[model samples]
Target: MSAPSTPPAADAARRPARGRPPRLDQARTVEAALVLLDESGLDALTMRRLADAVGVQAGALYRHFATKGDLLTAMAERMLADCSTPPPDPDWSGRLTALARRLRTALLAHRDGARVYAGTHSTGAGTLGFAETLIGVLGEAGFGPQEAARTALTVVHYTVGHTLEEQAALQPGDQGPADPERLREAVADAGLPHLTAALPVLTGTDFTAQFEFGLGLLLRGLRGLRRDGSGPGA
Candidate 1:
């Protein structure tokens, strides 16, 4: 019998899928990261966790993404992937409300939920897409470029802020409501009388009610801007 013949390099190259698994792209890696994020909060989303979630080694992730920050940027984008540039509309109030709901839904779906969305990561399409939608909606509301930009920023800022607060206040099936005094004393007695008196009407309610109230106030403020150039419009 001939001595064991070694396979040629070309033959070795033709090795079947039994050797190593296919490589994951940035998106796939990030998708796995998101899944890990949903299952465990951000604090728990180490490379090992993501790798385990994707059925790969931690080192494998570095092939597609450089570091955790890069992974996070991708994950953030994935969270808001469904949202995109807004279209012009006559019923901007409804449009705004819809945007708010969509945003709330997107943020609430993940673990650590809003904690994952605290700040900007400019490299992500998710952030850009959300910004584009808000700007377009505000522009359609009779706002000029600058006005629309600021208004969109404020709207999103408020949404993120409120969403974070809402997420922090409750857990799965916990009836624990927000401490109303937290919202009450937050308003100054002298300079912020309106906010003070409106405290019970505002913070005393459930998150759903509070969300609607704040959104209504935000929209009402825009109405004043629509009528006069006073709101960022000026």
Candidate 2:
């Protein structure tokens, strides 16, 4: 007998069969966390909940992420992964606009995504790469280093700010525009002729149009600065 022939069942138990289901990993962990976030906002995404979602013990999450903040930073970076991709458009302004649009779309894709992103200053691969792209475009477009950095920050801040407000407005509560008649009455009572005349446009907000319009204004200013050689210290 060959040492009483080790039981096949025992051998199989000692070594998981080839192609055994994959263990939980960082990518899968992030995916699970993101799904929870999309389905039920940020507040509901505790580590325990994430572990359960991924079919692991809560302590297992610590192997991938040291803290909740670490996870949130990872989540923000994941959302920004596409921004690192090179733009097809050659025009600097067009590239910047495209990046901004992509960021907005990513934020809007998840519930409270903007809030999650805005809450962190993550220096992850995706975040740094996106910054590099934005600043690199500005540098090639005749912006000094300082001006280029400022312009990049301006674009990012504007996108984050707008999306933050947009997401906030989506939450359930007294998101009151009130009655149309009441709004008209208030505007009429204000007695500012210019504002009164423009009340309809002001009261009816189109966020997409507003974002593009604001971005256009920023780009136009950068263009003017470049043409006049008045960028930064110049």
Q: Per-residue lDDT tens digits of candidate 2, residues 37-65? A: 87778998899988776666789789889
- Residue pairs clashing in model 2 are none
**Which candidate number has the best lDDT?**
2
Whole-model lDDT per candidate: 0.72, 0.80
- Among the numbered candidates, top TM-score falls to 2
lDDT of 1 by residue, 97-149 (tens): 88887888788888766777777475567778788887777776677898788
Alpha carbon deviation, residue 96, candidate 2 (Å): 1.3
Runs in model 1 lying further than 4 Å from the true structure: 1-19, 85-89, 172-205, 232-234
Candidate 1 lDDT trough over 10 residues, lowest sum: 9-18
Can you give the lDDT of residue 118 in candidate 2?
84
Candidate 2 accuracy as lDDT: 0.80
